[model samples]
Target: MKQKPIHPALEPYLEGKVLLVNKPLHWTSFDAVRKIRGFSRITKIGHAGTLDPLASGLLIICTGKFTKKINEYMGMEKEYTGSITLGASTPTYDLESEPENQQDISHITEEMIHAATAQFTGPIMQVPPSHSAIKKDGKPVYLAARKGIDVELEPRPITIYSFEITRIELPVVHFKVVCSTGTYIRSLANDYGKALGVGGYLSSLCRTRIGNFSLEYALSVDAIGAEIQHLKNSYIPPAGGYTDAV
Candidate 1:
């Protein structure tokens, strides 16, 4: 395979840099950052936001001085597209848990799905899932949940910029959502099921955008590593190392 040239600017990762990476499925946000760190000597790197291992999409990675702006980038609104399966609920609110309490979805209609979205639009009170990474007593709630411990959580306000139905099967609903930074789409799925009087759980999720960054422009792990290698070998050199005459 032909090697792609590295951008001139990426060589100075220690100074500061921002990279748009397309996170792969089953990979945590930190996993992507670790791969990038391996490509360079810079160790101040951090991802602007977190994506669950089950979700894949745009991940903004910052190095050196740019790491300070992670919170700012994380606060921006996000866009996601995914499928939710109705008529069954899960302990984790997604396929990560076993499907339970199946209900008849034959009675659900497209009109009902469209009309139900109105209730979730704009400002709404949302409760995060119990199996989430939220902290309780200085420990992650999911950790407690895995031990069969029940945790009480209060509803917090979140804004849903827009919610649209992209497709529908009897028990599966594919949709797009633009929501605030703290919004949990899993909660939205659970609430949506309650609205229709049929339990539901998230089956698949893919984040498409974050603020102005889109996954379409992101590079894969291998592509990024290769670019970094190219930069170090073909361009950058050690401070005391001298090159041969051109």
Candidate 2:
């Protein structure tokens, strides 16, 4: 579905700048970039990282010459907070797919949940979810998975600096994790459930930090467009209030 215009102030993005944006749920990382690109009429824009449509949080965007710095930001460690639902599994690993038959999570204890976290605190091997952006034979795995094709993906190395269960409410486990770049939190949720033998999947997710950049410094999509619209045009003189928010 097509959405409304982002903001009229986007033309200011033509000048080189790095922006911290709080991505909204169900909006692809590309969607955010497209809006900014169109608003600024600048074709050299790009994002530093990708976020699943099911997730929301900090996204670093670069424009003009700053786009060259994308790889540097993408290499930074990431921090995320989200909930995992025990007692069930999902094909997509999150709310994107329907849940399978649930297991008996009643027997799970708070101590077990806390103890299980230690197993994932260091380096680990994680298989990207079938319904993820990963490609198999040049096509996205999700396209084949949706057609009932079973794709056996290889597990790769990823480091988890820390994993903490912040809250436990029966079938739901709230957590905060710090990890290296390229770590898939959904896969982590799936693996965590399997470790406990109760079956689990990601229920919710939010990226809180990427290296030194935090969500606290990010502007909403609309707010960013508004800020850009406030920029001085070629016909106008420089205004005193215009300052780099990043």
Candidate 3:
């Protein structure tokens, strides 16, 4: 049987390469990985961290030997920018679920919002959302949540390097946060609204950075696919035949 052409450019990816992808909204982290794997044809690909389908931004995808570095990358600090909608809560803590438990934010003031940040900044214990990917009894807690089962989760310590409230427009509060690996911005929004005596939920989220890697340097899945196509297009088969490996 004839073998497929293996371009020299693809060799680097098979050996190992870290790709920065700007994950699109409503797409799971796995979706982005699958798209890259399909085009790059590198089976040993994995993403450093998981982003909720409601959230978007920088996703670090490692291929081949670089997959081993996923854990290391997962432990690094992350930075995010998003808007938290006060006066309403959600089951998923974000827009993935319907908003509920509405409250009046008439009493909420800019001073109160700024003060709330201090409570979450630095080291604090936070509970992960019940409707989250966190495993419980060998299954994702979200699976149980969907069946109306309540999962009790203990609070875990996470450092919020900084939490800056950049804009405030009544029910919507835009902010930037630099936090530790395990920090969940959804929980932070909930807690912040609670601190202000008004329930809150994450309306929109975008991870701008993970450690030193920024979303600005990342490319979309389509762009990466085009790059792969370009490389394949420029392929020059060896004298005998194409490579046996993809």
Candidate 4:
């Protein structure tokens, strides 16, 4: 059997490296990690946080020894920018499920929308969407939800440091949020709409920051793959032929 080549460029990844990835829409956080692991061939790799397939944005990928810091990163505050579609609610609280229970947003003024945010700001108890990965009876709650089974979830306390309304176009409301680690923007959207006496759901979401790490520094999955390939191509075997150990 042939051993894999060891390149100096790849050494840092093995020792430990924190990578910022711009997770693509419909791609789970694990998808990005799997791609990086496949290309880099690093067995010890994990992401700092989980991003739903419906959302896209900054995903912190820790490799090798850096994987230990996953919890630390996960505890950091997160920032997101997205739009909430009012006048309808979804079972999933987002586009993951079909919108239902439509309402009229004609009377929903900008003043009312802005006021709604204040109620959600600061500390609040949020009930996660039914179509979520939260565990119940050793199974994901979403599984039972898909089977049309109701699984009552307790409201968990979360803090919203800030919730700023950026734009308003009747049914579509654009906003930015900075919140605690476990805060769910989907729930925020839903609650905000209900506060205004109209239904709402998360239409689009993008995480822009996690603590000091920003999406601005993130690279796409393909870009990271190209980097790994470049490193491999630049490797040169020893003069006496490659050895088994580095």
Candidate 5:
């Protein structure tokens, strides 16, 4: 395979720089950061945001001084495309965990699904999913849930810029969403199900973009791995790390 040369200005900044990586499903954001750090042979590596293991998409990774900008990336808005199985509720919002219960979705229609999505658009009070990583009593709620303990969480305001249902088949609904920072799509899925009188959970989720960066310009893990050695071998070092490089 031919090696791609590193850009000149980018070379210095990247000596320990930020890389926008396209993460694959079933891999945590931490996993992506680790891979990039290993590839670049840089110790100061970090990520700007966290994507659930079930989610696939753009993951901003920072190396060396770029790690200082991690917080900047975290402040940006996010766009996601995913699907929720409308008739089921799971321990986690996605398929990573087993469903707590299933409901009959035969009565649901595409029209109903579209209409239900409208209620979620704009500003709304959203309750976080019970199985989320939110802290309760100083412990992650997921930890408590794993122990078969029920924890109470409060609902917070989240803006759903837009929600479009692209396709529907029985209990499954495919859609896209643009939301503000701190918004939980998993909770959105669960809430969407409740609105329809049936519980629901996310079966699939992918972060399509964050701020001005889109997955279209992201590098895959395989591609990064293939070029790992080259990245470390050449490059001028840049100064100052970023907070949101992950």
Candidate 6:
């Protein structure tokens, strides 16, 4: 979809400022960057990290010269709060896909849920979700998976610093997790369910933190655009407000 044009004021800030944006759910990280670029009226905008379409949270965007710092931010740890529906499996490992079936989860206990979380903490091997953006044979895994092509993907190591079950109601579990950069929460949800002898898939996901930045510091894309419009043809300013908010 074509993005609307930027407001007049923000054109000036597009020159070389970093933007902290709160990415909305169901929007790709690229979508957020594109929107920001449109608002800032700069062609040199980029995001530090990628967030799944089902995830929402802080998305650090750099414009012009600030784009140099993208790699630095991408390496930071991330935190998330999400819900997993137990007793079900989805092709996408999330609510975005059709669930194959729902298992009977009446026997699951709160204690088991708590214990299951521990297994995922610390270093663990995780297989990337088949319906993910991960490249396999030069094509996104999701594309191959959708084409009914079975691809062999090995499990790789990823550290999960923390995984806590905040709430549990039979087949639904709410959790908060802090982990390394490459960790995939959807895969975690799938693995967690399997560990418990049931199935599970991510129902909702919200990124709370990424490295030193948090969602608390992010500006809505509209708000950032408004600020951009207020600055206009003036020289773009430093990312003072951007850093402070994140």
The number of the candidate with the highest lDDT is: 3
10 residues in a row with least lDDT, candidate 2: 1-10
| TM-scores for candidates 1 onward, in order | 0.91, 0.89, 0.94, 0.94, 0.85, 0.88
lDDT of 4 at 229: 83
Task: Give the total clashing residue pairs for model 1.
Answer: 0
Query: Taking the tens digit of each residue's C-alpha lDDT, what string does model 6 give over 1-246?
Result: 242444434444444676778999889999998887666557777999898888888889887677888998888999999899999899888988888777898888888889988889999999999888889878888898988888778899999999999987767799999999888899999999899888999999998898878899899889987776555544344665222110
In model 1, the clashing pairs are: none
Off by over 4 Å in 4: 1-8, 237-246
Question: What's the CA error at residue 181 for candidate 2, in Å?
Answer: 1.3
lDDT (Cα, tens digit) per residue for candidate 2, span 25-49: 9999999999976666667789999
Error of 3 at 49 (Å): 0.1
Better of 2 and 3 by lDDT: 3
> What does candidate 5's lDDT look like per residue over 132-180, in tens digits?
7889878788888878887788989888899999888767889999998
Over the stretch 1-246, how does candidate 1's per-residue lDDT look in tens digits? 232333443547767888999998899999999888777656688998888888888899998788899999999999999988999999898878899998998888899988999999999999999998899889999998999999888899999999999999868999999999999988898889889999988888888999998989999988998887766567644486544311
Q: What stretches of model 2 exceed 4 Å from their correct place? A: 1-12, 233-246
The candidates, ranked best first by lDDT, are 3, 4, 2, 1, 6, 5
**Model 5 shows how many backbone clashes?**
24
TM-score of 6: 0.88
Model 4 deviation from native, Cα RMSD in Å: 2.7
Question: Which parts of model 6 have CA positions greater than 4 angstroms off?
Answer: 1-15, 233-246
Arranged by TM-score with the best first, the candidates are 3, 4, 1, 2, 6, 5
Pull out the clashing pairs in model 3.
none
True lDDT of residue 211, candidate 2:
96
lDDT of 3 by residue, 1-246 (tens): 232444566988978999999999989999999999889877789999999888999999998789999999999999999999999998888888899998999989899999889989999999999988899889989899999998999999999999999999989999999999999899999888888888999998999999999999999999999999888887777898675435
Candidate 2 pairs with clashing backbones: 9-228, 9-229
Q: What C-alpha lDDT does candidate 2 achieve relative to the native structure?
A: 0.86
